[model samples]
Target: MSEIKHEVTKDPITGVETTGHVWDDTLQEFNNPLPAWWLWAFYGTIIFSIIYWIIYPSWPTGLAERGFLTGLSTIEFTSDKGEKVTTHWNTRALLAQEMQNDENELKRQKMVKEVAATPLADVVKDPTKSAFVLAYGKGIFGDYCAACHQSGGQGVIGNFPNLVDDSWLWGGDPADIETTIRKGRKGHMPAHKGTLSDEQITAAANYVLSLSGEKVDPELAAKGKEIFNTKGCSGCHTPAATGMKALGSANLTDKIWTQANVPGADSPEAKIEAVKKIIAGGIDREMPAWESRLSNDEIKVLVAYLKLLSQ
Candidate 1:
């Protein structure tokens, strides 16, 4: 092996000093000192960082405390029990406090009062207020109603009511909708397995399908209709199969089957089973009361959106 050699040299063209090194026997690095301004700027950043660390909550000084070292701007005080506690000033906390100041808070309170005093019909007549109400309602729905009704109020079939459609288990009047949201609703359908025989249950399922104008076995539907009237189904669901709003019973005369899956043109069995299971086990649906959870103004905002959905 041969030893490699290095020496400081000058470039003939530029007359610049080299870094006493060469690459590929030709290329060399210039040996130049950094400019004073650049060096001072770099050093300034280091000094600033040190100062910032000392002035803010930066270092974890103790494992047991699970906290950072108290800095210059820290708020320190002794508790009622005489234990020392410290918290540092932060831009985020300052901004939050500023947001809750009297002027802004008063404005918000005024808006709430105005919305509450205004009737929903008149509220919707005003374009700006209507937009605010709808947006506010959508957010409230996402927070409270979305978990069960689903986002956008599409609702899961068989489990939750679909709000997109005009039909409603309870009346869809604006006041009714507001009442439902505030007080909530519970619908009870008694299990019929013990009350009716297997054959009657099958017939009842067929009769329910017939009410929806679906093609069902006429003879079975006839038998089911008779059983339906006698088995206390009409107590909630009226004789005409139009649900009673007072009881929150579902309407049977329409295509909407609350618990039925949307079956294709060929898959009628799936639709039948959906209704049959309900007859055997019954249907008990519940919507929680939001009176305590939400403000009256908030409920009105929700009603505004729900009315829009019905439209």
Candidate 2:
């Protein structure tokens, strides 16, 4: 093999140094240094990366409990229990610190305090407080209540109650709504499968449908009305077929069907079957109490928020 020649030269045309690499005999490669700004920017990025790694969490230390480098940077914030907490710089801690010190957040806290002090009725009446309750309460609802009641609060048929409608199992009063969010509610309907025959159950279902102005069999409904009054249903539902809020009984007179998906039924027979199924199988549902989980102020905001939704 022939020895390769290495040469360096300067091009006289622009007076720039050449790498002495010829492509087509005359054409040469320029030995140009990187631009000063570009070189400094590159070095600056390197320095920034080093500083970032030192100040923030970066390298894995391979330790079990303390898996990563804690870094030199620290974040300090007041915890929920009113205690000062200092920890390694993290987004979560940073957000907490911001929430504590941010001007918008401070205003929100002040508004929450005002809402807590005001009565439920007054809170809804006040424009500023009501607006705050609606906006803030939406987030709270999405976090807590949306899981069960749905994002729109329309609820699931045969499971959760539709909150947007006028129909409320318990009373619709502000105090009642507050109590519901605080204490929670349990719905119970005893099975009549053992006591009443299938015919009686069907008749009772027909009567219930008729109460809601559904075109049910008159003779069957008459028989069912008797069974409804005598079979201990009227004790909670009342003789008028109107529910008692104190007992959390559903009103039969209303077109709204909470436990039974009667509205969803395609045919009249299917509708009757829906109600019959509830009567025969019985109903047992529970809404978990938020009193322990949520603060009174939060619950108040939720009550107002729910009321606004229903309206």
Candidate 3:
């Protein structure tokens, strides 16, 4: 085999050094140096990557228990039990530290404590407390109540009760609202299908609708009135059809419906059918208790917020 040789030369035309490589005995490769800026930029990236790896969690450790390389960075935060917790740097720990030190977060905590101690009536009267309740309570309501009552508290037609409306199954008083949030409510209307005939149920429904000023057959409504009083309906709803707040019975006099979608019905027949279906099937819905989930102060804020919304 012939010995391979390299010949380095300079081209007089461009005055650039040759790479000592030739092709086709004419074409020569130039030995050009890389730009200083490009070289520095490449080195800077390598340095940045090394620094990043040293400051944050990067490579996974071979040991399963150790997980990843935690790096040199650390975060300190006060735990709920008042213990100082120093852990490896993480987003959750960073947030906790921020919550403890943030100026706005500190102010919010102070306001929460102040609101918790104040009377519900006084809280509504005070401009500062009332404003806080409306602003802060909106977020709380959205987090918890909005899932059922909707974002604006308008409520779903048949699924949830409208908090924005004046009509309330339970009393709408501040104290009443507080109790409701703490204890929760279970609405129950026994099904009449087992005891009452189809005609009797229809008559009762028509009578119930008539109480709300809905036009119905006078003869059937009169018959229904008799059945309503005689049957157990009066026991919960009361004889006057004004409803008993203590029992969470719906007031028949008010046209606003909670369980039955009476307002949604287009035609008179559909309206009658809607009410009749409710009478036959009955209702069993519940508002879950928040006492365990939310703090007492949060419940108070929610009460004030809901009361304000209704107004």
Best by TM-score: 3
Q: For candidate 3, lDDT tens digit of each residue in 1-311?
A: 33434788999889999998766666778999999999999999999999999998788988734688887899999997899999888899999999999999999988988987888789878999989989999999999999999999999977899998978888998889888889999988898999999999999988999999999998999999999999988999999998999989999889889877989999888999999998999889999999999988789889889987887
- Kindly report which residue stretches of model 2 are placed more than 4 angstroms away from their true locations once superposed: 4-38, 63-65, 147-152, 213-218, 235-240, 244-247, 262-271, 291-294
Give the Cα lDDT of each candidate.
0.79, 0.90, 0.90
By lDDT, the better pick of 1 and 3 is 3
Return the lDDT, model 2, position 133: 86
User: lDDT-based ranking, best first?
Assistant: 3, 2, 1
- Model 3: residue 39 alpha-carbon error in angstroms: 2.7
Compute the lDDT of residue 163 as modeled in candidate 2: 88
Off by over 4 Å in 3: 1-4, 62-66, 182-184, 215-218, 265-270, 289-295
**In terms of TM-score, which candidate is stronger, 1 or 2?**
2
Better of 1 and 3 by TM-score: 3
List the lowest-lDDT window of 10 residues for candidate 1. Answer: 260-269
What ranking emerges by TM-score with the best candidate at the front?
Answer: 3, 2, 1
What tens-digit string does per-residue lDDT give for candidate 2 at 260-281? 8898899999999999999999
**Can you give the TM-score per candidate against the true fold?**
0.66, 0.79, 0.85
* Clashing residue pairs found in predicted model 1: 158-259
